[model samples]
Target: MPLNIVLLDDEQHVIDLLSAYCESIDAADIVGRFSNPIQALNFINNHPVDLLISDINMPQVSGIELAQSLTRDVKVIFITAHSDYAVAAFELDVIDYIVKPVLLPRFLKAISKAQNAISASEPSTKELGNRELSNREQSARYIFVKDGGVKKRLVFDEILFLHAQGDYTEIRLKDKKLLLLGTLSSFQQLLPEGEFVRIHRSYIVNKSNVDSVDKDHLNIDGQDITIGKTYRQNIDEIF
Candidate 1:
């Protein structure tokens, strides 16, 4: 499942850049983006967030103080134009401290660290067929995908299956299909491992939507998908 992220920056342009970067990564979802530190804190208190990227030099409630006041263990990454606050920011044990303007490579490196920390701390997340690695994971029920130049929300339960088309993925819902600009392997990283299974070279089906299963074929939404030879054993174990 993707990480829920919050962005807090006093500047609107900075927030826009961060939002675009987060959307491009596909490994995270922007749960909230605020220009006011106080408002961002309120939302973070009431929501489940995995990471927070904040500008340290805000008018009210500096990012250092905000990180200290968090009610839960949410990882923080401080971004500031001035390097003078680095010492104080690190005292709060933040994930990373980034200096503005935040470049793409630096942001990606920090995100990778946050992902590692979250995966280690996650109490119940599935790792493909290894149920023993974790119990049932508490994951977001939906994901955001851009389609037709507009971002669309796709619920996990509403999705029937996924079809790989070279570098893009076709998400098959009950009524319509939404295409995403990503490979099937990359898209799988964002999916709840327990809920979806790779049954073929080009298809991944929602386990709860399965109607029938045989040695070579599995049925989902009344459509039969041939099970890949390598994945047949997984089907047996999962079913």
Candidate 2:
């Protein structure tokens, strides 16, 4: 039987591109395309899918959550614009993650990955995988944080680190910064376990950005930061 699949993305252009490709592919049956995550989730619950092609960043809920709910029976290939989500995406055991704006060849490669995952035997650590998948699902790869009345969606990969000050979280981006309403713990939970570590109670740094680490000090992109006593052991393993 041809693999039954669903494609979910907030961008109509992306959905149009992927839908066309899936229709052209011989092995897949393009079941539907949904811009809304809730609608996609409902459809998946009512249907049996062999594979799902989804966007990691979406409004309200993410593709990660949808993938977690159907991981046992369906393979997921996430499409995202950021690289930081890559670590968490892998942890979820997604067949692949295709960064946007997605090229046709790359999108096809994701489909290939899903096919392989479907053919592969069930993994031994289903429960552990499920739990890990849930954490990654709920974690935000792209945050729609509000600065006053203005709302902005920031990709997590663009953020250098978050600085906590009382009730607000300082979002330091690659180019600029934004002071948003959130806690340090909330940002930490959104980051992948091995890829991001809490260097201090108020700071979460991406391991991929760390230039060097010795004892209590960590150098990330020429910036010096200290490792908290509580997070020392965990940081050590990553370095």
lDDT of 2 by residue, 120-184 (tens): 75653543554564465447666455577777887767767778875468877778888865456
Candidate 2: which stretches are off by over 4 Å?
122-239
lDDT at residue 70 of model 2 (Cα atoms): 62
TM-score of each: 0.54, 0.49
Per-residue lDDT tens digits for candidate 1, residues 1-239, read 78778899989999999988988997887766788899788757644567999998899899988998887678999999999999998888899999999999999999999999887775632222223312222255776665756778788898899998864789899999888765565566557767899999799999999999999999888888899999989999999
lDDT of 2: 0.73
- Residue pairs clashing in model 1 are 124-137
- Tell me the lDDT of candidate 1: 0.81
